[model samples]
Target chain A: MREQGRGDRLTALLRRGPLLAVLVLYTLYTTLPFLWVGAMSLRTTAEISADHYGLPSPAHWGKFRAAWVDSNFAGYFWNSTVVVVSAVAIVTVLGAMAAHALARYRFPGNRLIYFVLFSSIIFPPQIVLLSLFQILVNYDLYNTRTGLVLVYVSLQLPLTVFILEAFFARIPQDLFEAARIDGYTDFQIFLRIVVPVGMPAIVTTVILNFVHLWNEYLFAVVLVSDEDLRTLPVGIQRFMGDYFQDIGMIATGVMIAVIPVIVVYAFFSEKLIQGMTAGAVK
Target chain B: MSAPADAARLPAAAAPRRWWPAARRGERDPGAPSWLTLMAFLAPALLLYAGLTAYPVVRTFADSLYDLENMDAPRFVGLAHFVAIWSDETFLRAIRNTLVWSFVAPFLDVATGLLLALCLYAGVPFARFLRIAWFTPVLLSYVVVSILWLWIYNYDWGALNLALRALGLDGWARAWLGESSTALAALMVTHAWKWAGFNMVVCLAALHALPSEVLEAAELDHCGWAAKLRHIIIPMMRPTLLNLYILAFIGKMKVFDLVWIMTQGGPMWSTETVSTYVYKRAFAWNTFDLGYPSAIAVVWFIIVLAAAAVLHLAFRQREKLEY
Candidate 1:
């Protein structure tokens, strides 16, 4: 009987073995494109074309350097940085203030304001694409970094305000009353009290807004026509148009665009995940 | 700054009892503040959002009435552009593609996400590691993700073809993104890859928050995996699924980057979505007909609104489930 039980256990193990192997294989299949891109980036066009199935040679090492210059990646990198950082900073400060008020205070039209912000999420971006472009051109803000920053801030404000408001609303009310008793002005209370307690939420908002702004392509493409003002996405288009056959360099350029996002994720992966998923679960 | 003082100056009785009855019961209401406090916090965001988002949206409607490129005296061509789009093959194709893109991609992505969440929830070995690995694609910009996949789908020396050849299935390999028939679907699959992690993360959070006892009870009742998921888990996850569906729908409708990167809505405009088609009309094709694009955009907006309304009504009666 013991031998029979052992045989049954062996069969179970055998059944599970293939399932486990398949899962591992599926995971690899999912990630193969990423790994392949990295490998292809390191290979020269000749190396990629010559073997068709062989490993990349050492001759492709300079492709990254060539992509950097040929793609005008430095300009793209700078433009993206300027627009994203500035938009994140501005939205963070403004969003915090709005969130604090909406959460803590009772005022006429407060519900109306909340609905306005919330409903902004429903406005399809394409609807505003033409008009925003026209308005920016009329103001002579089109094709400028400031114009892109404004669009980013507008695009990002609703989400940031929504998340931050939810966070600020959770702060213990006694803390505010205590600060009030201590004669701390509202600004002082916000600056010294709410800001400190809300650092986690703020950080999350900053990371999210940064990612959104950095990845923005529509506004960048529509508004900025000059090659000099192009952000990373637009810059990549220029690179692709200019070097349609240089797959190695185009891959290298793409890999460069992906690095910052990965680095940011590595540092704030936890908070970013929590913040994003929080809305869905609730 | 002076607003708080002004608020304080109001007669004490008029200000109402500021003491919290909830505090006496060891519960606190966080929304206890004077009007001044509210203004100090809320005004800045309202102003910015109004200036940037609300204003531009209203302006879009107004701009649709005029022909800006012609510098023609701001003539109002009410509904003419809308009428014209019905005859425009590009616009019609874009509408069809956008509908397919939004509906199909979201369904696949959400379903994939739900499956992944279930796998992780079952405590599959290396589950945590799988979560991180799957999420790497989400971190990549659409620019990079599209480029990487385009190579993998390349005809001659592509990864997919290479894999097929390795498995002695060379006859099955094809130019995934090059052909018009498969290009849209290929793009949709790439989109699913990029966002499946996002939806999975969302669903996983909800799944984790579900009452474990309920699941256990279902299991004890001889409920198999499929039955338990269908009867217990999915019913509980209805609201989340609806919200994510709306979000995914809107996102797919407005998709540009991956399509732009992979095929540029090309190979004879086969995959030209509404947003991309509008973009082409206004910019690439330089049609000088802003009204037409705006009309298409307005229709897109209406479809999104319809989706949101339907979802909202469907989920309206659900009990708020807290994590």
Candidate 2:
């Protein structure tokens, strides 16, 4: 029995050897750049230039402070927070309302509305870029935070509704029926019952949308050319362009942008995965 | 409770009364809410979607037929911009590059994702930790990702070249993003890195959804790993693979951020794509001709729709295997 067990162990090792190696290599490939960035952010530009791959010696933690103060990341960060928060809040409430109606109500143009909204997923935003710009300008909303918020909400509405629809459908109809029997109106039942039950879906959409809107660059770049209105992504792009030579400062700026997302992912990685893959997998 | 008198008193309300709770009436569940209530529920979303998304899309189609400049009235110029795009060198280059990206990026991403998912499915050591680590990039914004890779791909003091020089292979290292020959490929590598993990998570989910008994059956049949993968696992994974492929294809076709931040279609327009070119024509360039960019967008949209339709039909023809 002992001899056979030893032999089995050897065979298993041989079987898993190449697979293990590939996994390790791939993990390193994905992670090493992040590590390098962290290390580079702590070192001076001269130190980085001297030994690009070396770890920071006596890490210059002040680089982040400098990046925040000098590069205007703080202002950009504030703008991103405001825009993402407002957009996500509106998207969640509005998306839930629409999703609830679609999932529960049988009305005229229901299927048509759902199909129209769903099909819009395949239409990339670039298709509407020219006209969207024109419309935003004509509405006297160009270069305004409110304009960006409106665009962000509209852009994310489809996915938010899509995710919420699935979750809302899974909700037990009996609860709503029971509420209705208790003299609760549709609006009241939706506000009181549907919103509470749909919290998980709402949270998922919020995190996902937050990540997307916060990172949104294309629209932010095109629609808002004013420096005061720049979001984090655009701000960082411009910072990188100006400070191309200052690798440490650039890395510091990137870390500021990246850390929140990493923290969110760490806390809610499963929800994040489920939310993102919900459309494709289904 | 007097039916004849009530019906006579409210003849116009008869249809609505019957349709109000349509499900209990032995017909379709027209849902429980009244039309007015349902419309109230839908109004906020409908207004936003229509005013912003739907209207703009329709307007883009209309705008493509006009010759409009900044603050200028749109003059009808039916298909002129579209015809001119075919002869425009930069636009043609963008189209070519976009086509290349659409084909190459998806294949690489899906292929890499499948490999990683298969490894995880086979059960490697610390599989949970490795899965999370692999998925780290998916959480990062493209701007951060671009910055990370920018440092790595920097000509001097970048990790990539520094590592190459340290390995005594200095000849292989060059300005990765600056050269026309390598710019597109370099940009694609960044895209693949960011997205492969996302695809892996998707594929892993699909794999987990697969029945293990069938895999065991194949093993019991003395099928080798390769043979089992070919005859059993792959066939079962067809629907998922097709879905991932289509998603990846569409994503790549519309990809803008990485290229815009990393290369900006530079080094003589080597990495120009439909998305970037549309932006350039409409905004970045001083031309300010909305009509031309609208033309590009309309054409690109049609191509995307056609491609999606073809893929859908192609994938649909194959019989899905039921477990």
Highest-TM-score candidate: 2
How does candidate 2 score on lDDT?
Answer: 0.82
Tens-digit per-residue lDDT, A1-282, candidate 2: 999999999999998889888987898899999888888889998997777778888899988888888778899999999999999999988998998888777766777787788777778778777787888889889899999999999999987887776666655656666676789887788887767667766777887788789889989988898998899999989988987888878888888998888887888777777665556654
What DockQ results do all the predictions give, each relative to the true complex?
0.43, 0.43
**Candidate 1 ranges with C-alpha deviation above 4 Å:** A1-9, A18-22, A276-278, B1-40, B71-73, B317-323
How many Å off is the CA of B323 in candidate 1? Answer: 18
Docking class of 1: acceptable
Per-residue accuracy of model 2 over B159-243 as CA lDDT, tens digit each: 7898899999999999999999999999999999999988898788778988989988887899998898788878888877877
Instruction: Kindly give the stretch of ten consecutive residues in candidate 1 chain A with the minimal lDDT sum.
Output: A273-282
> Tens-digit lDDT track for model 1 on B1-323?
34334333422111001110111122233446666666667777777677777787777777666655664566678878778878998888878888888877888988888888887887778987787777777666787777778878988888778889989998989998878989888898889988888888878877997999999999899999889999999988876786788778877867888887788887778898877887887888867877767777787788787876776655554535432
The Cα local distance difference test for each model comes to: 0.75, 0.82
